[model samples]
Target: MFSLRLLLSLIMLVGIVLTVTFSSILSTRDAKHEVEELFDAQMVQTAKMLEQFYVDQLTEDQLAQLISQPILFHVDDSKIETFAEQANPNTLSYEHKLSFQLLSSTGQILAYSDSSGEQQLTTFNPGYDTRIIDRELWHVYSFFSEPHQVWIVTAQRDDVRQELVSLIISNTWRAPLIITPIMMFFMLVLTYYLFKPVKLLERHLDKRPAQDLSPINFTLPTELASTQKALNSYLLRISETMIRERRFSADAAHELKTPLAIIKLHSDGLSDVLSSQSPDVKQATLPYIEAIGEGVNRISHTVEQLLLLSRVDAIEALNKTDCKLQNIIENVINQLVHIIADYEWYIVVPKDMIINVDPFYIELVLKNIIENACKYSPTESLISIKVTQDDQQTMICVADQGCGMSDEEIALAKNRFYRVDENTSQGAGLGLSICQHIISLHHGELTFSRVQPHGLDVCIVLPRAQS
Candidate 1:
């Protein structure tokens, strides 16, 4: 996945590094130029000083001796420390690299530093120039002295300026190298803080319940203000739509009940009248009357379930009371006794175990679960209602022994109108969905599991009533 935070951090890091690198390159180039200029100025000063002081003081015979034989400056390695001690301790070791030559106006070498050797540094150029002498590059500055009638050529090895420039550039880069990581760390921290509001909004949405359509109440940045406004508006529209849907379902179901009851009453009366007629007429008409009654009963069941589901959907909060688990289970079983009579029921519930829930809704939830068990299980099969409690919650499980549901069916058992075997059952399939909604309103859970050795287990978990 592409992370916005990572992308932003990478962009910022790359931008900062590029900026630093560009600055360093410019700084190094300028420093190299300034170093070269400073050294060139020193060479000019040395050449002028040599002409003004030493060459001008030379006698005619002394000048003639300089032209006779070239001088060389050689030092023994053993005496290098003593030489350094005699001179200034801070004197650079590359001082010998700086050499000067005195030439007569005719371009003949009149005198030279011992290190300059017999060769001229350059072609007696009167200004700054670069030349190679003895395979070593040098920066030479040649000056003409009218009174001395000579050329003062001062040259320094190119390596001297290069090494000095390298030292300066290296030092300059050290600071940025050390500070880059610290700057990156601060940048990451800054990015995190800058995007904190976005994360807050994401977490708010993630943790919110599906039924919760309330507007967001967070202080967001101006950048996200429009997004927040749009989100709240959408939620408002959804809430209004859901309210309208629930009202319609409840109203429709209520309207259907009276008509269905009238149809059932007439069908039952017709069935009774047919029973008193001749055997052939009674047999022929009774089945049709019973069929009509059955159809009415199924419609009534569906309408009642729809009404219950709509009511459960509308309840956002519960008026919870401490209700005895045993009493709730007994009431549910009594209501379903006619159908459950064929099944062997095993009830294991503590008489005093209580749950904090709305009594009416909890009873309805139990009735749906227990009735489903009775309907699905075969005659004489085992059905168990077990109540268990822990410190924080109470659990009630209803298990039935019959043909068990597959994993796919169990997964969608709580969805409305999703029957495991729709062909075999005459249900609207809203029973578990209603139970789920009621349990959710109580801050409880409803779950379905496939029981081993063939059956279904429906468990309800509600918070334990405080003592």
Candidate 2:
């Protein structure tokens, strides 16, 4: 995908090139027309000068000699030169392209330049005309001088006029051609710098943690402020909804605890009363009472988990104390002593390494993962918790010899209330979901994988606390 900066730069470049091209075309054409008009005026002026200066004063012999040889003098006598000498040494090798012919009113040639050869440049008409001589085209300007009773004609070769026009047009177009690319380069660079804020905003959003819904914190250009405001507003709405859900879960858990305890207490009392009866009465009544007790216990456990989920974020944020990794793991193992009774356990973590985190939340995550492993695995299965570190991050791996799950199950494990085995009703399937949220709050990741030879493995990665 092309960035906005590049797209805008291309647009401006195309527009500038087109505008320059169009302007050059129009200016060149106008310049060519002006040059042609000026050349024609000069031709008229030359004819008039010849008529006034030498036409009537020439004797027949002098006129005949002049016919064979053209006069070569600059209008300013101070700059006179022989016809054989060049007019401009700086110009391309000069050729005598200008020729003149003097004729009577009845079309009889009185005098003509040697350059004219044997050609009548045009009829004795009082205007401009194009004529061909020796297959070469010439532009001739003719006028009648009434006092001299003569027609004066001045002609220039068509090829020479064309060469002059081309030179003027090339010079006119040169500046824009040379300067346009430089302007386009700066325009592209300026456009990129001008849009720097937009690029910064994009990178900021892309790097943000998925669970971080905080408002953006940066000053923006006026044009982008509205976009930023809309994004913040949506984030605020999502935050409010999450807060409400957390509050509801906490309140419902608090409300259910009392009734669930009462139910357990009544079931235990009933079981005690039936134990004193005969074997036949005990057999049927005790099992029902035990089932009622188990149901109550399950409900109570679920309520406690819900309550922990509700307050995990706020609690973790408030508890920013440094604690040793070994101490936290020992506390979690103590809490799960009863559940892990049927499992073989191992821990490989340093006793001196410290982590900056909430002890309660960290222990809660460990408890949930360990409890999950025990619940799924067969009795006396091998379970291990290993911790290691690198320069930038801390890693914890929990492996269990449980029946492994499929790819689909591992993917959905982080979703709330999603269970790998739908037939098992022992848990509400919120254990891994809650663990994921807790890890994410601490800027960490929790991932599930299949252990080799029919087992499950989980890994937690967190950034190392700076000393």
lDDT of each: 0.83, 0.80
The digit string of per-residue lDDT tens for model 2 on 1-467 reads 77777788888878978897888789878877887798788889989898889686876677556556645422222242233354555332233467788876666676676556546786877889988877778889998988767788998777666777777777767877788778878987798788888889989999887667899976888988999999999999998998888898899999999999899888878887888999999987877887898889888888988887776644435365788999999999998888888889898998799887777878888888888888878999899999999998898888999897899988898998888777874777788888898888788899888998988888888889887
Steric collisions counted per model? 1, 0
The sequence of per-residue lDDT tens digits that candidate 1 reaches over residues 200-304 is 899989978778999998898898899999999999999999999989999999999999988988887887787789999987887788788888889999998
Error of 2 at 331 (Å): 2.8
Model 2's alpha-carbon lDDT is 0.80
Clashing pairs in 1: 73-114
- The TM-scores of all predictions, comma-separated, are 0.89, 0.81
Q: Which residue ranges in model 1 land beyond 4 Å of their true spot?
A: 71-91, 105-116, 131-136, 144-149
Query: Which pairs of residues collide in model 2?
Result: none
Could you tell me how far off, in angstroms, the CA of residue 353 lies in candidate 1 after the best superposition?
A: 2.2
Q: Least lDDT summed over 10 consecutive residues: which range in candidate 2?
A: 73-82
In the order shown, what is each candidate's alpha-carbon RMSD?
3.4, 5.0
